[model samples]
Target: MSEIQEEAVLEQDQIIVESGRPKMLGYVFGFFAVTLLGYFLVNRYYMPAPAVNTAPAVRFAPSELLNDLNKRLAYLQNRTTGVSFYIHTIRKKENLWKLASKRHYSVHAIIGCNPQFETYDVSIGQKIIIPSRAGTLHPVQKNDSWQKIASRYKTTLPELVKYNNTALDIGYGDLVFVPDRRPDMALMNDKLREKYELRALFVSPLGGRLSSTFGRRKHPVTGQYKLHGGIDIAVKTGTWVGAAADGVVTLASDGVGHYGKAVFVDHQDGYVTHYGHLSKILVRPGQKVKARQLIARSGSTGRSTGPHLHFTIKKNDVSKDPLKFIW
Candidate 1:
């Protein structure tokens, strides 16, 4: 009985050992298969390809290139010939004199670029074009030639024509830039120069509320729409009025025309200052007076609404805005 039991135990142990060998071999084979598959997938999809070199195709246009080169050459030639411009934005505390001095250009040079500047005074936040050199812009008149303009500015014809880069033909009102020519203040247009000089030479003779502005308005007494030639400064009766600038008294009388008791002073440069609506006249005709000198007293005289001084500035006998010359 003992020998048969030992033989059965040995047989069972052998069967168990033989079955475990196949399962172990299968697990090893599965792990190796998974590792090889992952390596193959990574190598196939995750690797970067090497870069290739290629030449780009070129396209050229002879006509376009020639035109562009010509433009660039013209621009360069103008720059070399002292013709270039830049714009300057006026900031707080910036003035024409200061800007001119800083930029090494004359004040007249800056004025030539901007025709709006009747005087050297410039306002804040104003944009002004500034030339690279000192010069002015002259408006072409009828029958104006490049040689004529050059002679006027004292420059050569070629230099004068070089200022204008766009076209060769010039017509009336075409502004021709004159480089390096500082304009004579006295030689400027009689009206324009007079207005510019009067701004600095004259002062407000009397300070008061502006009762009337110089423009087209309904006349208070006449009740008709007409151009008011002077600005009225509201003041009390017998308020002292003064001469605007040093000039010869042209007229001083009482009750003449619309200006009741008025005094007119001739500034001798196509400029005349008139003080009207006066209670009394202090200066007689042909008398010389200084600026701020008492000439008359304001009053509510002929065709007046109230006691005020009617002041006007005339250029070539044509009445202009008095406020432009005075306050």
Candidate 2:
């Protein structure tokens, strides 16, 4: 009975061990499969895809691109280095030509820095900024563009931008340097141009009350309306009258035409001055006279009503208002 029972138990044990071995092997294989699948899924989600081998349509060589970059850097440096500025105080006998000659700069450069000057004439004690290089300092206005500025100055846009060492964008009131350019006097403001022209005229010969203005008026002697060629300034007989400008006396005669005891002076430049109704003549024909020099005496002359001096200025033989020249 013992042997039979032992044999049956041993057989059952062997079967159970074999069956458990297969189950354990399956579990290990399943665990490894699941881990391998998870690894693959994670790689697909996180890792970058391989790059395609497509060529670009346009390609620059490395050397060429590098050279271009270096050139740009050098140009930027040169543009920055070219700019410099300093201020100067004007002195007597120092004109723009002299100042520009000293610095090897142009008159335009000086005028560009001093936008406040209405005329080419510079006064003593005037403060002006001088640029190291020749250029115009153009003030940027509203809606101003590099193209517009360049066109106005008759320069290229790239050159203008390069001269300024700035971007194409310029804000209002910004001063942009235009290289090798001058201020366009014709483009100057009307008031400023007028002021410039007015300064070019001769100073008044002498200060006196303006009894009559220039233009068409009722004739004092004829009592008829007509354009008076000259202006009548009332003065006592023998009152000293001076030359209005530097000139050569063309004529000094008594009772000439309507101008009684008149003296005519030729100031060149198509300008001529007439002094009529003189009590005495202090100058002779073909005699050179300076401005403010005593040339004649005032008196009733040239069809006048009372003691007065008749003065006239002619440009190219055209009569102009005396007040415009003397006042």
The candidate 2 region of ten consecutive residues with least summed lDDT is 49-58
Candidate 1 structure, TM-score to reference: 0.43
For model 1, which pairs clash? none
> What's the lDDT for residue 317 in model 2?
96
Model 1 CA deviation exceeding 4 Å by range: 1-196
Candidate 2 global lDDT: 0.70
Q: Write one digit per residue (lDDT tens) for candidate 2, span 1-327.
A: 599999999988787677898876887799999999987765434322222223322223323322343332332233332566666778998977678878887666776656666656678987666678888667666898766787788876556544554432356655567788876656455654675465356756555556787889988778999898877777778889988888999999997978889999998689998888888898899999998899988888667778888888899999988755553
Model 1 CA lDDT for position 20 = 100
Please give the TM-score that candidate 2 achieves against the real structure. 0.43
